[model samples]
Target: MPQVPIVAAHWVYLLGVALIVLTMIWRANVVVPSVLATFLVALAWTHSPIAALGSIFNASFTAAKELFNIFLVIALMTALLNALKVLRSDIRMVEPFRTVMKDGHTAYFVLAGITYVISLFFWPTPAVPLVSAVLLPAAIAAGLPPLGGALAIAIAGQGMALSSDYVIGVAPGISAKAAGVAVSAAAVADRALVLSLITGSVALLLGYFAIRKFITKPDDGLLERWQAKSSNGELARIAQEGTFDKVELARGTAGDQTPLANQGQIDKALAAIPDAREKWSKIFAVVTPLAFLGVIVVMVLSKLGIGHDLKGGDAAALVGGVAAVLMIWASFVTDPLREFLDTSADHVTEGFIFAFKAMGSVLPIAGFFFLGAEQGLSAPILGVPAAQAPNLLFELVQAAQHWIPGNQVFVAFGVLIAGMITGIDGSGFAGLPLTGSLSGALAPTVGLDPATLAAVGQMGAVWTGGGTLVAWSSLIAVAGFARVPVFQIVQTVMVPVLAGLVTSTICAVLIWH
Candidate 1:
């Protein structure tokens, strides 16, 4: 290990921070700054011109290594979700919530609650269309504003479910890995989950009040507003068939027909098994919940020393495997021979596409952060003297450790806020290794749990970057699907997101402290 330097690489780091801030202020990408910063730091430290060239390649490769698991987790979960959709189990999964959405107020809360729950397991990207397609129209008919529905989703799914990251464990795993802690550490997951819940609940409550008076009685007028703001084109297309018309049209349609008629035949052909409408719906209600519950059971059992020790990537593999199995069973049971193989392939393909779209941007971006992480990675990021090998960010943080406040809450919130600011670049998960490692190094001094602090940092990173707050992130797709202005979605979600952050911070301080 390189000894801490008496003279810090302050100027180099300052330049990096300044560049990042400038990029953010101008709404420009900071990837170049991240790369340039790595180069400068390495060059300045080593004072050799040639090493900068190598630093770039090695830094990105290091980043890819650290973050590949996150990409894989996303790919697997997304694939499983796609498979479920093809099997029609995705629709069946949410059917029970229909009963709770009898009116506007109920619909708003129901949407939030259901979105939060499902997004926790399967994630929000997949859950969004499923919920919006089914529950949204009902919510509108019940007088829930389309904007309100969008806000609820941003708060519950993107903010809460993702930030906590209980099921897939991507966020937590990244944080935990960086902090040198186990991914399934009880204290870590518990605190993160609680903080996420607190923030999400408070934000959602405040947000609902902000729009309370906007809720109207059930009316066709509400649908007009919903249509006016939402992606009317897609909704119109889905509506042309009328509510549940696909199900009806697909019911026992004969094979002999024209293309349109053939579509009905195909729909019937691919349609779920007999009374699958009711039966599969019930099964999903039971099995999906039970499957997740089983995960919890295994977690508890592992905690109690009864089963195989599962943590981090292992836990994720288990969850993904279960989802895949469910997909296979569901698809096969509906139409074992024909639709099974075809649907599985399509779902996996779509899943990979989505996974890349959601996470691929991070490669270059994270390559920038990884440069500051360790010298091994930085070798390619900065052209430097071979003898002067040190992790730039780690070294910088250590140099500043003397000046950092000693309070636990201050330390925790500082990491949280820093993570949030880092997320402003729109690659929310990009800053984890820095934050996590800092938390570990800082934890020893501030008397805080490294895992807990890392978890808090994760919430800031993921909720913002996962598309809840940022217009440029996944929020755009959400807004498009909802048929609303992206900025409108941001403004609507601002209050709730702020509330969630505050509440979650307080919860973390109180509980973890």
Candidate 2:
């Protein structure tokens, strides 16, 4: 890598990273500092306050554009859930799972096993919301804490399956190309798979032990207690679909947000509900699971024997599309055909509102980090040509590279640390090239195999940036599902996840390297 000019923007970006980390340490929301950092970085880079001001919106817009799929999945999944709620099918859908998930311990492993398998083929981005929507309720009812469920999903799906990317081979392909080694991409992917499982196992084991304390014994109130925390836009408020806190049926309105006009409309709408609610609920409970199971089956088949052609987004798009269709169908079932349009629109609108409420804060924070990434993700935020954009994060990594010793284990762990740093940008794969290049260069000098070193770096980069440890990453999806703050998810998984990464690197040096 060529020497990147150390500019004021670099310093500002570093300061911003520090401020956000400190705010997190203080248990405060990091959004303010993140927005401030983006502004400062822009001012330093452009030397114009006007340009800096525009950069805030630009940064957030860029991040939102990149992460819109996540927003869509959340919205559609919620819409589906809302529709099911009208039919009372949502409860029925998860009822059977309560049988399978007899306890919190059983639910945790069940969540992990299912998440790992789905994420291995479908990618965790979509699978997290899908699984969270279907299985998470059941898991909670079975006595698993919402936070614990989120932990299981993040570690098994994002940290484990994503780190390896075995089914797709995308991550290994990037590393292999940057590695510039004689080794094939498949070879690197194979090694990465082994290392990933080791890391995931360690992380999951430690994570399970840590979260066990939060698990409560099964009881009817366990699920209700969790629901009580839900806001007006959440599943708990489905009964209040249009309105009625105190305004009641007298006005058929509750502030300006009410969708219906009067008691007549309310009664009419209620009357429109199919008399077969119980029967339809039973049918949908069976059909909903079958639909999702089929999606999983088809996704696995589509990707299994293919030559590394799958994209993480494909599964998300597929699931979102299916959820949308199901939601519309359920709407028609719940209301008269004339009211179907209104009801469906209401669900869609609420879905978007909830999605933004849950994930809107993530944009600016993610945008701040994106300004330090490579051109494709950062160029717009910087208002610079793609080729001219500075990869400030990777450049920082390279600036400190010389301090690493020429010892094998140190170099391996050094690459691991570097990978973790570059991963701070939140796109885990974005750091792969830098880590892979470092591995290729440092491994030969330190008596380490580039493939092994590259795999170690892959594990670190993906596990951290992919979701388990970062608030701005796809971990927000897990947070949204669990209805907890993203920082809580980060804090919960940090110790175990880091321990697992460290142990995996040590094993790589001792065994693979």
Candidate 3:
């Protein structure tokens, strides 16, 4: 087959990607550069300013369309969590777990384990709220520092569970599809699961040790400190708005209006509930976890070939459907039947708002990357026929193969670095296709298994951009919930995440080859 020529447009795309990475490293927003890069690359490729302008808009539109399912899943899961909160079942759900988490060490692992499990079924975007709201407080109260609690959630949920994405299969699906691999995403998913565990374990252990010295004895004083900090922070915001009433200001002065006050009120209300209603809360709490457990069991059986496999979007749909049903059930239990509809609607709206707040900035960034992918949507936007559509990133990698060493070690690390660079935009899944495509293209040349290469890239991308290393990513959500500065969480996890990625990449080259 004749080699496709790399054009100036390809270099422009590379420059754009490089610039974006540089901006991220500088802790700056990359959106404007991404948008500009998209325009420049499109202009170079099509040589039409009109086409390039349209491509910018088309890129974001395509990204939103491609990733809307992720947004929907996040919304549904958040809505479900909110509904559970209404019945105080969210508290009930984690109350038992708190009993076993008696100290800082135990609390850290327990928090991580629960966050991992929940995040595996529902992506971390949704799982964060549930874990943060319930488990975070309990973990802190059990002697874990707030930053420690945030690290656990970030490592387990965003770094570990999302990187694997075995249950939902979204991450692997993107990779497999982009790679044009004949194998099902299940093949990649299995490998990713193992790699994610390896990475998560190393990172979590390192993280725990790094913060263990800061772990104080189980005391109310630590919790009070965090509460006072949160209250003072809120008071500052209220003061800036100049909206505080005298009574509110006085309450804030006493640090009595802490964020946990809402939870306290909910606990009081739960206590005041009729015995029948209260039983329902406990029942839903138990039932909710079991329902999700059942889903996992079914998926596991399917993975073992006992039943049909749930792949890609289907798996996400299964999770979303389950969450929706649970949301309705919880809403009905918590509110009058007539009000349940409104209650559910309110929850769903709130969930979408939260989802957008967390992820709205990702769309344009995803768009820029999507344009470099061979996803069919980009070709038309660039005013090229499907057959002639340029995959700028893939072509650049392909063209550079001659000069690039063919060693498997080099190839594996290259793919890992590429994935990490793509992850700079903070949507870990967004870059999977680019990494997957590169892995597929380069694996043959390097004589490595494409699946292994894909898995390696997945680890680097997710562990960095998914949340652990990047404060602008979903790590912020964990930070917010833990009431710590986002950068503090990033600093805490940086060494572990980088170490984990390096160790896992070496392992992938050695074990898989």
Candidate 4:
């Protein structure tokens, strides 16, 4: 393959990525560096401050356009979760899982299993609070150490489930979009699921082994000990991590609305009806789970050629549509007919607000990366014809390809490492575009599939930044719930999570290749 020449913009792009990584390592927000980097890169390319300023807007604008689908699905799913909360069904739904946690050993796996399932559906944003509030105490009483409980939640919910993002598909959607046309979200998601399971299984098993010695006989005092350890140590700051974590859970400030949007009508309806709300809550709890399960079943059948083939975007649409209908139904059940319109609007509004709070920070960072993609994004930002647009990042990769070993496995790990570096900012998602574009660029040179490489990159980015290894990320939320120090969560799970990531990367290279 011919080596592509490096240009001024290409050098600026590298420097920008390096500065962003350094910013993340310093534990600072990457938004400023990202914005600055985009401006500088644009300045280099266009050679005019005015054009660079315009490029900044175009970069972020283009990025938001590409990623709005991810935001929408997050909002709808979160809205559905809020509706479940309204019915109190979210609690009821998971209460049964507690009964199965008969002992400390069982509790560990049970907590992880339940977290993985819930996080897969609604994301760790909602699942963390739900599992921590309802299940964490029970798991603690069953003799799982608070730290153990925290590891289970972070490794399974945030690391494993979120890495794949199979249900919500936010992570994969971003990765696939940045990976270019040859790679589809469905393809990336499918590979991501396998990798996530591999990663989660290894980490969960190792975590259990690491904590098995501390597993005590079930005693009521266990919960007391755990609670006694809870202090105000950075508890207030824990809520702040939710800015990137999807919900301001502990603070209850993500999307707070009035306690009663239609207070009088709702009160009147509840007062007039005898146990109608409770009855509906119970009924919908059962129906809601079944409906989601059915959707999963249908999608599987479609994949098996027994029904219409739902592509990546189509799958997200299906999930979002179902969630909207379910939210409306659940809200209606909880709201008086006369007040239904206003009440449902409140829930949806809350969903969008929460979504923006959690995900809005990624727009600027994504914009910076988008400016480095293929002609479609860069041309718009650089104001060049598509055919003549600069492929700054990809060209750089090609120029440097000779410096990298030609071995696929070597290249695979390199991409994985690059992805992990990108994730240090802790958004878990802010790095997808860089890794995806790198994968697409490097795959042909290495005789591998871009989708496979993209999947590997996605795993690395998500598993690291999705909250498992970072103290300031959503791991703090887990620590807050378990009443442990945030660093303690990071330290305990660090090795196990790293092991899982390494194992998964190796598996991705061998299995998919």
Most lDDT-accurate candidate:
4
Q: For this target, which candidate reaches the highest TM-score against the unseen true structure?
A: 4
Off by over 4 Å in 4: 1-4, 235-274
lDDT of each: 0.66, 0.71, 0.75, 0.79
After the best TM-score superposition of candidate 1, give how far the Cα of residue 267 lies from its true spot, in angstroms.
Answer: 12
Cα lDDT tens digits, model 1, 224-342, are: 55555524454333223221121112211212211111123334533544575446545655786788789878977986889988754677777778877776666666566887788
lDDT of 3 by residue, 106-209 (tens): 99999999889878865676567666655666678778998899889989998999999876566776676556525457678888998899889999999999
Residue-wise lDDT of candidate 2 within 241-329, one digit each (tens)?
A: 21111112111211221112223433454455567676676777678768877776666666576433435466667777888898998
Candidate ordering by lDDT (highest first): 4, 3, 2, 1
Give the candidate order by descending TM-score: 4, 3, 1, 2
* Model 2 spans > 4 angstroms off: 98-275, 306-309, 405-513
**What RMSD value applies to candidate 2?**
10.2
- Flag regions of model 3 displaced more than 4 Å: 122-150, 167-188, 211-269, 272-276, 375-377, 421-437, 449-451, 470-492
Task: Estimate the lDDT of model 3.
Answer: 0.75
Better candidate by TM-score, 1 or 2: 1
